[model samples]
Target chain A: MRGGAIAILAWATVLLVLFIGNWIWDAKPVNAATAAFAAVVTYATGVALWLARREALRPGPPAPRSEPESVPQSSLAAVLIGLSVGTILFGLAWANFLVYFGAGILVLSLGRLVLELRSERATRRRLLGEEEPR
Target chain B: MSVATAPRARLARRGGWPEALTSTDHKQIGLNLGACSLFFFLLGGVFALILRTQLAQSNMQVLSDNSYNEIFTMHGSTMIYLFVTPMAVAMATYLVPLQIGAVRLSAPRLSLAGFWTWLAGGLVMESSWLTADGAGRTGWSSYVPMSNSTNTPGVGQDLWVIGVILVALGLTAMSICVTVTVARRRAPGMALLRMPVFTWTALLSVLMIVAAFPMLILAMTLLFIDRTGAGHIYTGFAGAIDYQDLFWFFGHPVVYVMFFPYLGGAAEAVAVNAHKRWFGYTAFVVSIMMFSALSMAVWSHHMYTTGGVTNQYFAFTSTLLLVPAGIEYFDMIGTLIGGAIVLRASMLFALTFFLQFLVGGLSGVFVASPVLDYHAYGTYIVVAHFHYTLFAGSIFGFFAAAYHWFPKLTGALLREGLGKLQLAVMVIGTNLTFFPMFFLGNDGMPRRVSRYPTHPEWGTLNLLETIGAGIIALGVLIFLINVIVSLRRRIVAGDDPWLGHTLEWATTSPPPPLNFEAPLPPVRSYAPLLDLREQQLDRERRLEGAPA
Candidate 1:
């Protein structure tokens, strides 16, 4: 994790150097703006790493996690959500009815996703409880 | 210490055809994505064959000009958007979790969703063919003014724009997931530097995707709106330049995005077959990061001849690409030096990948100079240059990876004899097909044209290229047959074939639902299994030396 943070920061630094170089040479709004966007993405990723664990910023190994994770085997909602987004976007160009149809499916999928997450959480809690006293 | 909860056992039991379509497991998603990408590759190849047939002789009018335009456009689009880019992601999604010793992806469901989104996007884009005007006839880049509704007005073009947006959006989502998984879900001892070579490459590739794909989505979305009469955003010279700026920002980095993961795969194949750990691992890592960053900065090189860009700046940054590229080549050579090199099919493909990419890289260096680019831009030389890089280079690396990992993915080995034969045919066919284009371009042959005026040299070269295209198709046919034969024969490859170096080899072939079943061995370095083997050898030597 620490190394991942450092790597992101390192890449961000490379981007910053290039960004400055591009800015000084031409300074076109489009060029500068795109370069800036790239830098922001790099920095944000670094920050996300930091937020995930303070250990990501420190020179050490990741702390071993004891809790067993509940890995989902399948998610029909996920599949529906993906297809619906594509359908809605395709509908934007091709036909209007698909847009409404896709939006409806998207809403239903989101609801189903929430339920799946809840069930997953409950399963994790039950497993942790079984292991707690042992 | 970790104890994995087996809560999904029941679901795993039902992993039939239906589960494969909706599975949140990284491996399943990766396989599905990869299989779909291969289908797209075949489709694109057919388009290429047809285009080559049209261009076989001077002034041949087998297909109309507009139909030729649509074929070439879809060919490029399918190869880039649907095949190579997604295939790279597929490899990473399938392998990264195993390489980093994670049981599952950080957001498994998100990864599943991304795969479907990308698939749907591909389908929608292809569906453009059903429209009255046919598929997106504009080139894959679809430069504005020319691509604007005023010039190329059609629902097909509109659908192309929408499809591109969705593809970028979906890949971006998946890339973010992979990025976070690397940042957060690595095993306790699998520090970032200790991660396998492919994982690092995948990391950098996804990082570039996270940074650049958004620009693609934004550009295409604006283009879609502009097409729908919302605004005339890309109008004159400035508008055209702005559109190029936005599109190329994604365009150029995507070449590297298409290259790096396969480079990682080839590097692994080379190192493993050579019986060596990767040479200069730290330097390789640094170079790839620098390489990717530099690629992002050099997009304007494509626009230099347009006279609207800062040629000097672009040329400088573009030429600087040679440095990192040189480091990678040197690393490959260093890995091979004084090592027990085995010419396995995977190794041969890997070696060929490096060698062929050099031709592309050298040609790129020629075009990097603004003076040379003036002559080369919009010519067959440019066409030849990219095909060498994107197809000859990346496809070889892709095959190397497929050969190396097919056993792990399917619990069976691909036949070496057939694999080698395919490689030989492909090498001959690829070179024969694309090499003469360089000469054609130098002789003032233009690209993307359906017909050509009679010229002895141009006509002859076109004929050769058409023949080469047929040979390449035959090679692909053999490969498909090999796959069918190998699967039926089923030469079961057990866990740890080739005495693999990564953590993946520690698990079963076609690994279980949770990836690893037993406790993972100690993670001391990038090649943990290799480290384990060396330690065991040392212990045996010490025991042999002791008094008994």
Candidate 2:
């Protein structure tokens, strides 16, 4: 749930700023086509990532307790908030820069999820080694 | 085992080079192949640098078009046929048996025969380079009409035709040995999936060569027959592109055949250097197989702009090629995804290869689109594209594997710092040189031209490219220096310096006439040596706790 919320807020903040930046750059506003393309890519990727992360954190999942000792959820939430707020600030005038940063974070977030999965696998292997064989 | 060595046990080292030449021992044969391939590798590299230097500038004729053609042809022919293929074959004959618990290659005599034929063919091809018409001027692809007698004259091209067919025959013979050894000689417990990825790649490579080279032989023979005026085979209604169809029937798959071993070599090297098991061994192996099969289907991609071929069909196949190619990317990235990353000379080369081959592969995708193919085909863009594929994909893989295995082959570690410097320069110089050609090609520079006409605004890119060529030459020279110095001054590396898991590391630094005394036991996992190391640590810990 938290992952999805973070992803939505982050995605919206970045998109809103980029749209406004185009608003400022053009005589009226940037065309629907280019902005639409970027928005569609960003939003789809963001939502997918958020849903995946939220599924991982759900109580019934095998990894329900996996994040318990890792990073504090509150801190992750704080970081997400800061990024969302910063995007809202610079999203207009610095639309290009925001796009780069947002895309990077998007990719990095996906990578972190992957690394978490790998670590879980490694842990299961170690745990298997510790158990007595039948 | 005791048949031949008993006689020469006393007088063996006396004949030295001669004994090595006449040796039927698998190791000596391997050593010979390794040494000769190394010699040719450097030679091909020099040809490449010289050609690059020529194309670096607009055209004062450091070399003419024909000379450029010969140099490029020989460069490719030398690297793929003489150097890389034979080297891999040699490694297979020498190492795989040891790794697989075999006493020797399936038939050592056939291997020796293969070697002699290969050496002779290499000599014949090399000699043609010095001849009047100057050695197979029709590019390595040697497309028809251009390669046809009506267009190209002289015995030199004929010799290339004959020599390649001969070498291809020899390679076919060697491939059978490799296949039999793998199939028959693996340790009792080693199943197909359990075989090392290198061996898997080797087996697949030999298979490709066997199937494809026969077609190449058939094509070359038809051409040879036409040249002698025996029949009007290529002289008929289809003319040269018929030969193009026939040749690329062999030509396109041959590219991956030459490269797959290097790719296999790189995968193994990356696993060894990373000190972790390859992340997805099965996926990686499957990807190689995918590339091999998909490779044949996509040959028409090369014919996209060949004037009369259907662009629509070629473009469709080329795009479909991306799936298998992308799977390889997935496997490659997966291999390194979570392992402990070690940034050594070999690892650095592997990483750079990943970066460069990705770009190269992507550009290949771009060229696959029919519209783009229409614009870029026959231009310098195509040259830029393949050079990227060859250098970044194949040659870079070669350097990574060579540096990684140099110790195992020679019992000496290459100077790592120098190796890294050479790799960096190569990476930088390669991009600087070839990247601009994409622009030049887009701006309307045709390949195979000595001088650009005054109009195209090609001056600056050409100049920049030439400068990069010089740097690349220096970088390659540095690699040569590393090899030379390592011969005398380098640190001695015993077997298993990198903790290699396969059976090759189960013997001495430089193994004797026979690679091993007892065959290595099979493994449940790829990292047999790692398991051994962990066991040793556990034993030591237990010993320390004893009440002694």
Best by TM-score: 1
Cα displacement (angstroms), candidate 1, residue B503, comes to 0.7
Residues B1-548, candidate 1, lDDT per residue (tens digit)?
A: 12222122233347678988888888888888899999999999999999999999988888899999999999999999999999999999999999998888888888888888998899999999999989999999999988999899999998888888888888888887799889887877787788899999999999999899999998898888888999888889998999999999999999999999999999999988998899999999999999999999999999988889899989999999999999999999999998899898999999999999999999999999999999999899999999999888999999999989988887777888999999999999999999999999988898999999999989999999999999999888988998887777777777777888999999987788889888887787889888888878888888899532
Candidate 1 residues lying further than 4 Å off, grouped into runs, are A1-3, A54-65, B1-13, B546-548
* Local distance difference test values of all predictions, in order: 0.90, 0.66
CA shift at B343, candidate 1, in angstroms? 0.8
Quote the positional error of residue B126 for candidate 2 in Å: 2.0
lDDT of 2 by residue, B41-113 (tens): 8788788778767765566678877788888888878887788677777766666776665556765555665
Cα-based TM-score, every candidate: 0.96, 0.74
Kindly report which residue pairs in candidate 1 clash with one another: none
TM-score of model 2 (first chain only): 0.32
Clashing pairs in 2: A17-A91
Candidate 2 regions exceeding 4 Å error are A1-134, B1-15, B307-314, B455-457, B535-548
As for candidate 1, its interface RMSD to one decimal place is 3.0
